[model samples]
Target chain A: MSPKGPAPSSVVREFIKDIVVDNRFCFSFPAETSALNKSVASFGVINPVWIVKSQDNRKTIVSGFRRYNAARKAGLETIPALTFKAGREYDLFIAHVAENTAVRKLNVGEISRVIFCANEHFGHGFEKISDRLFDALGLERSRKIYDMLLAVAGYGPAAKDIVSAGMSLKAAYRLARFEPDQRETLCKWIMDNRYGTSKSSLMIDMIDDIQAVKKKSVDEIIADAEAHVSPDMEKPQRSSRLFESVATMRNPILARMRRDFQTALESLNLPPSVEVIPPNNFEGRHIEFVIRARDRSSAISSFKALSKVAEAESENTESSKLSGLFGWI
Target chain B: MSFPGFSKILIAEEAVSTPLTKKAKAAWPDIAPQIVRNLADHELQLDMEPDPVAAGKRTLALGPNRGKFIRKCPGTMGLVCCNYWVIDLVEGCPIDCSYCILQGYLTDRRIRLATNINDLVDEIDAELAGGTQPVRVGTGELSDSLILDPQLGLAETLIDIFRTRPRATLELKTKTANIDSLLNLEPADNIVIGWSVNTPAIISSDERGASNLHDRLAAARQIVKHGWKVAFHFDPLVLHDRWEEGYRRVVDDIFSVAPPEKVAWISLGAFRFHPSLKQVIRDRFPMSDILNSEFVLCPDNKMRYVKPERLKLFRTLKNAIVAKAPSTPLYLCMEGIEIWESVFGGSPRGDKNLCQVFG
Candidate 1:
C-alpha cells in the first residue's frame, strides 16, 4: 500500500554499481534524478530499491529506478535494497508496474512498455487483459487503447521521446501506423511544430487520406503536404493552411466544390450580420441564411437582399450561381 | 471434408448424426471430426497462427441451429426496410471482406453451417405458411449462401424446398462462382441468385478468396441464361480515385450479361461497417485502403460516408444505372427516407414497384 512498495524481509545496503538497470522489468520514464540526487547526497537513500537475483546470480533492479539513478549520480558506494529470488519473468515485470504505478502516474511511453510486457506475458494478445490492470493504471478498459499502447511500445526511439515528451496517446497511435522513418518525420512535424491534440489528429487523418488515395509512402505524402504550407504564416494560420492543403490533396474535387461555393457566396457580399449557411454535405435539399438584425427595418433589408439573390431570373444571376452549389451535391 | 480447405472439422455432438455430418465424413475419410458437446465451451487454441481469425476461418464446424434460423433482417435503426427476410443456413462467411461486420461482432468466428436443414425448412414454412404476399428470403446475411454450397449441394436442396412454395421466394447470395449444382436444376421464378459486386479494383484489394469481378459477372450471365432471375448488390460502393469510372464500367458489364428484365432487383449500399472493424482490417489486410475515407457515424451507429458524399455517390451510380436500365426495381439497402428522397426524389415507401415488397 505504501508508495515505496510492499516491505520485504531483510532490507540491506547493496553496492549501487551492483544494481543493474534491468530494462527487462523496467516501467519508468527517462531518469529525472536531479532533486533526488541532491536529496540522496544529503540524506542518503531513505527507501530501499527492490531487486531480484537473476538466473546467473547477478542482482537485477526490479523497481526504484529513480532512486538507483540518483544514488549512482550522487556517487554513493551503496544503497539500501530489498532482494528477492526471481520467480517468473511476468511476475517480476508486474512487480515493477505495481511499484511505479503506486508512486506516480506512468507516462504514455511507460504505459506502452507495461502493456507491451503484459501482452508478451499473455503470449497471445491482451484481449483477456484484466479490468484490474486497466483500473490500476487509471485507464479506460479498451482493447483499442491497449492495442495502441502495445504499438507505441514497439515504436522507434524518436517516437518514444515524443510520447514521453507529452504527445496525446491518440495522436501517437495514429502516427504509429506508419513505417518508422516516416513516423519519425511525422513526429518531428507534430512535436517540433507543437501541434495540439485536435490539430495533430486532423492533420494525421488528412495525411492518411492522401496516402491512401495516392498509394504513396507516408513520408512522400508528408513531404508533398508540407511543401504547400507557408513558412511566413503565423502558427495557427500555418496550421490551418497545412490542414487545407492536405485536405485538398485528400479530396480535390470536393475541396474545389467547397472553395467555389465560398467564392460565389463572397461575391454576394451580404452584410456582415447576414450569414449564409451551406447545406450539410449539401445533403437533402436545404440552404439557410441568418440575419442578426437590431431592428425590423434591418431584418427587412436582409430579406430584400436575400430576395435579390434568390429571385433573380437571369441565368447569370446570383440565384443561378447558387444553383451550381446544388449541382455539385 | 463437408467444406473443403477447412483445417479442422469441429462438430456439435447434436450434429453427429445429421445428414451434413454424414456428407462430411463420406467426403473426407481421413480427418477425424472433433465432436464438441457445447460449442460455447469449445475454443480453438490457435495462438501460433499469426492471425487467429484467418486460421479460425480455415476451421469448419457443423452445429444445430441454436435459435430460429429464419428471421427478418435486423436492419439498422432509421434505415429504410425492404421487408427482406434472411435464413442463417450458415453462421459465418468464408469470403473475407475488409468491411465485413463479422470481423467486429461474430463471437463464434469459425465458419459454421446449420446442420438441421429439415428444421430450417420447417421454420421457413411456418413464416410463409399463411402469407399470400410474396416473401423474399435469403441465405447470405450471416454467411455467403454458396461458399460451401458446392460441397454440400445446399443450393439444390434449398431450391427444391422453395420450388414447392411458389409464394416463398428464395434468394441465395454469394461471392463465389460455384453454381454448377444450381445450373442443371430447374430454375424457378421464386429462386433468385444474387451476387455481391464491386469494382475490379475493390475485388482485388479487399475481397480475399472471393471470385473476381469478371468471373462473378460470367457466373451471373450463365445463371440468367439458365432462366433464373438474378440480382446484383453493389452494397459497398466504395469511393476511390476513378471510382465513378470503375462503377460505370461494372454497371455496363452487369447490363451486358444479366439483362435488365432478367434481373429481379439491384440494391445500392455504401461501404459501411462498425467502427471497430477498422482495426481488424488494418491488422488483417494492411494493404487495404478502404479505411482511408471521410466517414461519419450515422443514426444506426455504423460508420458510413458523409451524407453529401453518400448522396453524391448514390446519385452518380443511380444515374448511370438508370441510363442503361431505367426499370430495374432499384432500391437502397439499409438506407432511410432522407437518402431515398435525396437520390431517387422519393422514398422506396412511395415507389409502387418497390412497395409490393416493402409496403
Candidate 2:
C-alpha cells in the first residue's frame, strides 16, 4: 500500500476521507455514472473527497461516495483523501456507528441495528454506556438507539429489516413482545409494509396495556388482544397445563358477595331518576371498575354488599385492598 | 321555627344518641355508626318540618336597582324574555372570597347544599314567559354557580334547559376549577361563563376553598375554547397591603389564556359591604386583611374607600385592564352614576346599555 500513512499536505488532491457503505448506512447516491457527470458539470465539488487505499497502492473510494462518483465522471483520476485509522474490524464498525449516529436525520431503527451489532461485537449492556458520550449524543437519541438495538436482538432477523425500513419503534417492540408462534402471523404483514406507522403504533400501545393487566393469565391477555385486533381469528391452541391453571382459580368469597350486591341492586325498586349499570369486569377506559345502582338508596344498599365482600375477602388476606377499593382513599 | 321546636329537636337529638342499629353497626365502620346515628336524628327533624320559612322560593331579595332594558341597549338584556331572572342553583358557598356577602349573611358553613334546582328551572320557564323582552339571568349570587356542578351535573342540566330557550341568558359565575362536565356539553351563546378572579395572594389566603387565579382563568379559557363567551368580575376588590402587584399579576394571567374578544365584559367594584358584615367577617375570617382597612359609609350605608382611595385604586386597575385588553367593555357592578362617570367616564345608561356594553 506504499507504506499507507496520513496524506502529506502537499499532495494535489481533496482533503476528505471515504464514507464506508454497508447495511448500516441508509442514505446514499445512485450507483450510476450519468447523474455524477451531470453534477460535476453544474457545480464543482463543495467539499474534498475521501477514498480507501487498496493493497498494492491503488486508492479505493471510502467516504464521499457522491463526490467520488462525480470526480470520476469529470475525468479526474487522483481524488483527495485521508487515511482510515488502523483498528480491529469491530472497532471500525463502532467508528461507523458513531459517525452515522451523530447525523441528525439518521433513522432510529438503523441506528439501533448498528448499536446491536456493536454490542454483539463488544460486550456491555446499553445502560453501562458512558454518560458523557450519552449526554453529548442526547439522552433521547441514545435511548432510541438502544431501544432499537434491543428490539432487533429481541426479535430475530426478518423483523429487524421490517423495523429498520421505517416501522415505528413501539410497534416493533410490541411485535417483539409476543411469543415466536404468535409473532409468526405478523411477519408477512410487517415485511410487506401493509401496516402503517399509526396502526403499528396503536398495536404497540395496546400490547403494553395488555401486558400490564394483573390477575389475568397469559391466555386471557392474548385473548383480549386478539378480540381487539381481529375478532375473526380463532382461539390459539392451548395445552392442558395452561387450561388447568385457569380452571383452578377460584374465589367463592368474591363470587358470593357479588351475587349479594346484585340482589341488593334489584330490590331497591329505584325511582326513574336513577339509572343503574351493573358492575362490569372488563378493563375500562378510565375506571377499572364501576358498580352501578338504580338510585341513591340502592347505591347505599350496594355499599352494604361491598362491605360484606370486603369483610369476607379480608378474612382470607387481612389486607386493606378491599377497603381501598371502596374509596377509602 | 319556634323555641319549643328547638326543644323538640333536643328530644329527637337525644333519641339518636342511642347505640346504632345492628344493621348500621355492621354496614359502617367505627365513625360511620356515629354518622348514621346523627343522620337519623337530622332526618327525623327535617321530615317533621319539611319546609323552613327561609327555604321557600324568593327572588331579587338583594341586588342593585334595575333599569329599563331599552334605555341602555336596542334589545332586552336577556336573550329569551324581557327582564331579569333569578337562578337559585345553589344557596350557600363554601369558598370564602374576601368580598363574599355570605360572610355577612349566612349562618351555615355546609358544602354541597342544593337550591331546589328542579323548582328554580320551572320558575325560570314561567318568568321568561312574563314578557317579550329577553330576561338577563344569573345564579352565582346565592353561591358560586359551578363549585358543586361537576358532582351534581348541574352545569349539564342548566345548559340543557338554556339551550332550548332563546330569550333566557343564564350566566354561571364561579371561581372554581370544576369545569369538566360543562366542557362536554354544547353550551349555547345564551350562556355566558363568568369567573370571579383576584390576585393569587388573595386567592391563597382570602378565598379559602376556591381555585387559584391560574386555575380560574384556565377554566375560563377552557369554556372560551369550547365556544362560550366569558366574563370577569373584580368585585370586592380588597386593597390589601400588596394590592397593586396582586392585581397586575391577575390581569396579566387572565390575558394569557383569553383575549379581548373572548371576554363578554369585565366588572370592577371596590370592596363595599353593609356595616353588619364587618363583625360577621371578623368572626368567620379571623385573619382577614380585608377588615383591617379604614372605610367610610356612603349614603347606601355600605362601606367603601373614601372617594380618593377608590379613585386611585380604580384608576390603577383600569389602566391594567386597558393595557391587557383595550377593547373589552368595563363596567362598575354596583357603583352610582357619579362614581361611574368619575372612573370610566360613562354609565350603564345612555346609548351604551349593558347588552351593547358586553358586545
By lDDT, the best candidate is 1
lDDT of 1 by residue, A1-329 (tens): 45433335499888877777766656677766577878988998898888887689798887788888888878889988888776655555656676678888788888888787677744536544544367678776655577678889988876786777666787667767787888777767766567666666667666765676677877787678679987788887776777677778876656766787788777766677788776544433456777899999988988888777665635466546666545544
Chain B alone, TM-score of each model?
A: 0.95, 0.74
CAPRI band for model 1: incorrect
**Per-residue lDDT of model 2, residues B196-315, tens digit only:** 888777678788768888788888888888888888998778787679998888888888888888887787878888876654454346566675544555555676765556767788
Tens digits of per-residue lDDT, candidate 1, B245-311, equal: 9999999999999888898888999988886676678778888888887766655667778777888
Backbone clash numbers for all candidates listed: 1, 18
**Per-residue lDDT value at B113 in model 1:** 81
lDDT for each candidate structure: 0.78, 0.53
> DockQ for the candidate 1 complex?
0.20
Model 2, C-alpha of A35: deviation from truth (Å): 99
